[model samples]
Target: ESTGRPLVILDLALTRDVDETVRALPGVVHLDLPGVRDAVPDAEVRQVDAARAIIDAEADDFERTLAGRSMDSLITALRSHIGRVVMEEIERLRPLQSRLPASAVPSVDGRADARVVAGGGVIRANGSSGAIAVSVAAPETTSEAAAKVSSEAADEPVITLAQAERALHHLAARLLHQPTVMARRAGQEGREDAYRQALELVLGPDSVGGTHD
Candidate 1:
């Protein structure tokens, strides 16, 4: 996508003094690039690099205080939040999975090895707004894996579990953005029945995405 530039992203999570945790984050964030960015090659990359330099300078602001909360509570909250995030995401994506062929999403090894995470993380899940802190434990290595995934995806699109889950969350936020719009004025029973049937098409048994199916 970048004519071969490896890009890195930063996500910021913070905790405040009070009930800020109860409010759910709204939809995605979008960045608009001027027409010149497309007209002039690499304009987007230049701008992004400058923006990243400013963020790197303020890295300390991204740190959080874990004072008062017990390690157990923090871990528990993390597990709970991650679980719900994944579960809701699966529900959201079941429909998409049903429509797309398995070949449409190749595994990491290029042989359907399912463990490969998505090749890109540009569109990612922002951690729960209410959570105190977000932590990740991973090997101190990524280059080898990144190179492999990138090479494979260049030939055919490859998807990872994390990528799939993130896509679901992204889709759910867009689909459910307007709850009021879901209200219908037609024959209520018939319309509602039709809606449920449509839902079943994507999520019902024997759906294409289901492993067993």
Candidate 2:
């Protein structure tokens, strides 16, 4: 989460308008960078990529340097900076993160992440859990049943994004198993009886009876 460069510590010794400079660069905030620390009012640029080279070299000088008095005289290591960065990113992702697939959905412990799918009309993601379990009785030749379901769902009230996601998962699973079930039952001896049984498997006795003419 702390993958982005959040801190922008300006060298008051070499640059002026630290805040303005930071604002010029996208996503650069003075909040991450501590108060400025400078040895000289302004140091002229002697070469190119000097800052990059120093960062690449990874040589630390804080141990050797003692406390100083300047507008940039802040200490105690920028420990909280990284944390602040991560929190900011998490906040950015919270809104749509729940809609993401289970693989990409991270376990957001504190925030209002969809960590669990509550039963019935509610939706949630089981805290860091695998795919949601869906069941269907749309046996042998689900084309008619699936088509009917789709048609009816189209007329229903607008569902929340979470509900739509759950519906998608269920529809995908139902379609996947449709062929397998049809193949197994295709070779059955009785034609009319088999068709009736399959229809019953799909809609159950109550549904079939309710639809009778």
lDDT of each: 0.39, 0.37
TM-score for each prediction?
0.22, 0.22
Q: What is the C-alpha RMSD of each candidate to the true structure, in Å?
A: 31.3, 30.4
lDDT score for residue 161 of model 1: 60
The deviation in Å at residue 54 for candidate 1 is 46
| Candidate 1 regions with alpha-carbon error over 4 angstroms | 1-71, 102-156, 160-213
Instruction: Check candidate 2 and list the clashing pairs.
Output: 35-72, 36-72, 37-72, 115-125, 116-124, 116-125, 116-126, 117-124, 117-125
Candidate 1, residue 82: the lDDT equals 45
Model 2 spans > 4 angstroms off: 1-121, 131-163, 166-172, 175-180, 187-192, 205-213
